[model samples]
Target: MTTESSDARPLPTLTRRSGDDLRCSIARTLQVLGDRWTILIVREGFRGHTRFSDFRRVLGIPTDILTSRLSSLVEAGVLERRGYREPGARERFDYHLTAAGDALLPVLGALAEWGNEYRPSGHGPSRLYQHAETGEATSIAFVTAAGAVVPLTDIAIVPGPGENDPGVGPTHPLAAHH
Candidate 1:
């Protein structure tokens, strides 16, 4: 029996997420946080980049794209704009991360770990996450219902309190495919 060549690229699986009935938190989240630009903006905000000019200078992003992303973040309650004046300058907006935005640290950590492990950029990691008190490097993991951190092998996904049939039910065709 012959196997497919290792160099072969697999065909892309086409699927459309059910946005109309997006009762899933992850779906609703992706809509607001949007894309890599939005996520990177949030990361920079966490890194203490509050001003628009600094975001543009560091990210090298176009003003229009930065403007749109900042607006969307504020609208989503993930960021709050505060009036600030630098020395002799007139008042300008500084984007501050909200409580909801602060809660995404775990998600960011998980994504960073996955990227470093799988889809590397050849350049070694540019930054590291450390525990504030212990000063040790930190990593993310899946925890159990009992609050015990466990390996992916030890975990199981079952129905939870938030589980519901929101029109696009659990049996939705795309659900199994994913």
Candidate 2:
């Protein structure tokens, strides 16, 4: 099935299998952070928990799983591993968030906000997002290039430049629209 977009172009109907051949940013991102444990490790990184033992203790994650997740994050450029050693002790590594990882703050905030609203625990929010300098509350939204915050109802998803790549040819539905 397909739907006619505003420009009278037919939009591709996506299914679980459709993403397998598509150049999708969300799909690529999920390859790095799809699991609960991986995301929680990122949360720990944001909270300044860098040591392996600190992550294990705080999240109660199994040693093998934590090791795998941390290794994957490092390989994906989400975390940077640096060597640190105390005197007379064996060298160890601490994980720090790279720019790519630090940029996930807004994604984390959006996830938290959605959870608080739709999956409430019946008590209250355990945490809130606020400005560091002004202490003002903040929330994420779809902002236009002109700095206008558009309502969710007004939002639309259209083909980006990636979908319109000339090399991809008309074999891809959206590529034909370009």
> lDDT winner among the candidates?
2
Global lDDT of each candidate: 0.75, 0.80
TM-score per prediction, in order, is 0.77, 0.80
lDDT of 1 by residue, 3-56 (tens): 233432222222337644244556566777758889999999889999999999
- Candidate 1 residue runs with Cα over 4 Å from true position: 1-21, 161-178
Give the top-scoring candidate (TM-score): 2
Worst 10 residues of 1 by lDDT: 7-16
Flag regions of model 2 displaced more than 4 Å: 1-22, 164-178
* TM value for model 2: 0.80
Candidate 1's TM-score: 0.77
Q: Give the per-residue lDDT digits (tens) of candidate 2, residues 1-178.
A: 1221232211223234454435676866677788999999999999999999999999999999999999888887788899999999999999999877887898899998999999998988877899999999999997887999987666656665668454553234333455
Q: Distance from true position, residue 127, model 1, in Å?
A: 1.3
